[model samples]
Target: MRRGGAATRPSLARDTGLSKPTVGQALLDLEQDGLVRPAGRTSSGPGRTAVLYEADPAAGHVLGIDIGRGRLRLAVADLAGTVVAKVDEPNRCRSASALVRTVHDLATGVVAQAGMTLSDVVKTVVGSPGVPDRGGRMLHLAPNLPGWGRRGLLDELEAVLGPGLLVENDANLAAVGERDQGAARGVDVFVCVNVGTGIGMGIVVDGQLFRGAHGAAGEVGYLPYGWTDTDSEGWTPSTPGILEQAAAANSVVKLAKEHGVRNASSAREVFQLARQGDACARAVVEQEATKLAFLVASVSAVIDPELVLLVGGIGSNTDLLIDPLEKAVREISPLSPRIAPGELGEDAVLTGAIATALRAAQDIVFDRRGENLVTQRSGVNA
Candidate 1:
């Protein structure tokens, strides 16, 4: 009853492809283990009235974390996907070591607020920037946070978070979040483009994340824009590409200042002034949109995703960016996909992390209840 709760034995048997007797025995074992409990009887079904069962909230817990350069978000949920507690705080730590410690402390604190401890968290998912290596250890090209791309990043996190830990790319989690409950609900193929202090893309194809061969599928910031052969010669695996430097939030402020948009220190102010009809600020925003359009065009030409979700601090301003951005994409290439704003706002990564954690937690909780030794199953089924 992890998904569709409170089903009859026949319904459960049909859904799981098990015999009615097997489903009955499995339910008994799960009830014995306290993983599931009767939730009253069904009253209005076609067949005779039947008893119903649901997942017990006491089965286990899940913890999800979103670590960004600016803020750290944490949430704890139960077996039913209900959020128990949450914590959102600005990230003041400058070094990776400090950040790791802060995450550990915050995780513990939130779990405690949820009336639990670390041991109760059956699964923990962390959403972070950068591409994780094949070993799921070191993060690559994570320049926004100081000293994060170094090796042993996951080792440190695992040490604190304990087992059943998953560290995923933040942008990937955003796309997952959008798919689970946000804009991409039924979208089979799409990309979530995150634009903030840095830029990244997360591809969802056929209802799943498409991490390229080496787990670096959606590193769009590394895409070449203004790089020359000389620039390529100096580039390394850890170095971010010209696209991020020229198209990200910092570039917005720089372009705004160059265009004589006075007192613009951040991209937010530029967008605000543009909304207020400041000609120079609007010009800066238009340039930014064109850059984003070219980036979108390049991506659309390759994968041809059905939708492009613009997210993050600068990207969520779809009202101002969409018209110009789409027009520029049409001008740049014929392969233009429908572009839209992300529905989850700034918390997309955290929402994704929670959903992923809940999925894993629910799976483990139910699958363990169904698992039986061959001998046990033979006797029980008989």
Candidate 2:
């Protein structure tokens, strides 16, 4: 079933090196259980056209949700991994309770748009900004979203979304999304650097997602830049990390202010001004590019990945920063990892969440083919 496309019984037998009778019997069982359905017949060949079998679209459903500082996105997909509906909205909720209600409403609406209900969803994966602690009780390193790091938050989410819900770091999901379908496809070792309102990284090594011992492997925003531990007497513990404070959206606006660019509220506005030949804005962008280049050098010096994918709202603006970033990195480091804009854009996290949910749903569905039968059946690698 990992083929992800329809295949005939004969093809399945050939691919798995199983007998035709075994493949036929497995397909029959899956069909009877409503987990597999007949697709159209194959093109005419030597003798007769063979019917193709595919995972049943109606047998199971999954939901993917991306909860970000500025927006909330949701997508509904079926057992076959086809996305049927998607929705995005500005995130105005200030409190955790409001965020939970919003998530439920958005998920319900998207599922309804796909002609299904929330109860029909077999698994749900949420991509967010922080890593859950060892006990899965609280989320840490998510200062942008107020009231999100409190204890018992995961329990509250599970209570509302059911036991099949999972929470993952948004950047990690973005890397998975890219690896599965976007710029990082087939690249074994790469880094996805997401620069938006905040900064983070998603590391993939040896064709697998590498979450460090504490599930905080990619939290590069904490890298010390302008700030140091000896000068931390007046710094707030919850303040934005050093590198993030120096390079993210707030820093852009701060740099703009220092250079006398008036009335620009957002980084997007700053970039626009830079494009219009504003010298101050241009300087700010140069500084941002230089900081990002230093970040890339740091990463390249450590892991030496094959590629680096720049994602998120500010990072994806390839027209403005790509050239400068490349030049800066080349100047500072001997290692040269190809840096490219994320192809999936805003949908990367949602796509990744859906992909993860689909895999989990498939595992559950296939495991239900009777425990003994799944294990004893010849060449049935379920």
Candidate 3:
């Protein structure tokens, strides 16, 4: 009934392979529990009309929050996956504590706008820039947000948002968003390369997120750069990881400055100039695209994904980057993984978080069957 939107008793029985009496009894049980309710009647046959049943939207709601470096995005969805309210705001808070408070405020505000309170939300999923600690105590590898990876941060967030809250990596969530609603739909194997304030990859193999052995499978920032020159006269270890130093947003600005694009102050500006036919800015963009192409090629040589979804600020400019990027990748490697911009755009993380919450809340809203399947699938290896 939930998957098909609505079903009559006969249809339900036919789909479930259950006897008619058993289907009737199950529908009665679900209706009594307030999880499923009847919609308008439908006549599949010529004789009589049958009542259609669907998962009740009023039973519960799910909340999804995306905590980005510069912006905070949120959405509220009913149990049946309809978005009721949404909020997008600048992240003005400088400290992690302040950011947590902002999240609580925005979450409650959006739910209130949806004609509900925090009590009405059965599940909440927060997409932040880091690997979620399975112990549910801290977030790892989120260096852009100050104090984000401190010990006991998850405990602090849970205290503010109440129980039934799950924190997930934003990049991984973007990949999920693409898989569930964007370009990667029906794709069994793919990767999402997110280029925003930082660089990260989300690997989906066999239609599942592969977080590697230590919950860091997609942390491509640490990928080696120029390490083949083993006997270099001058090689220095830097704080910024290899991929980050060479390919992140800051690197775009640095490369533009090195190429004499004196007026450029940001990657957005550099891309804009390139689009306007500025030689220096175009060179900068090509350089950045070439480096990102190398990363794509490297990932292809390993996982050999069928498609790669580019996301975030850099990825949004697909019109300018795709041609040069594909050309460079073809020249560098024999592998030709199809690359394209993600459909969800900047809201991919929030959309994925909502999808995650909907999946988790659906289990609890209807019946507590066995274990928490969502948590089990996302924990440790999420």
How many pairs of residues collide in each model? 0, 0, 0
TM-score per prediction, in order, is 0.90, 0.90, 0.88
**Model 1 lDDT tens row, 197-261:** 89999899999999999888988898788677776786766666778878888889999988999
Between prediction 2 and prediction 3, which has the larger lDDT? 2
**Model 3 misses residue 64 by how many Å?**
0.8
How many clashing residue pairs are found in candidate 2? 0
User: Each candidate: what lDDT?
Assistant: 0.88, 0.87, 0.85
lDDT tens per residue, model 2, 1-382: 5345889988888887877888888788778877788988987578889989887877888999999999999998887778899999999999988998889888889999999888878899999998877495878999888899989888888777778689999999999999988999999999999999899899999999899999999998888876666746655647667888889988899889999998789998999998899988988888899999989999999999999999998888777898899999999988888999999999988888998898898777665653345345654544
In the order shown, what is each candidate's alpha-carbon RMSD?
Answer: 2.9, 3.3, 6.2
| Model 1 segments more than 4 A misplaced | 9-29, 44-49, 228-237, 373-382
Residue 161, model 1: lDDT of 93
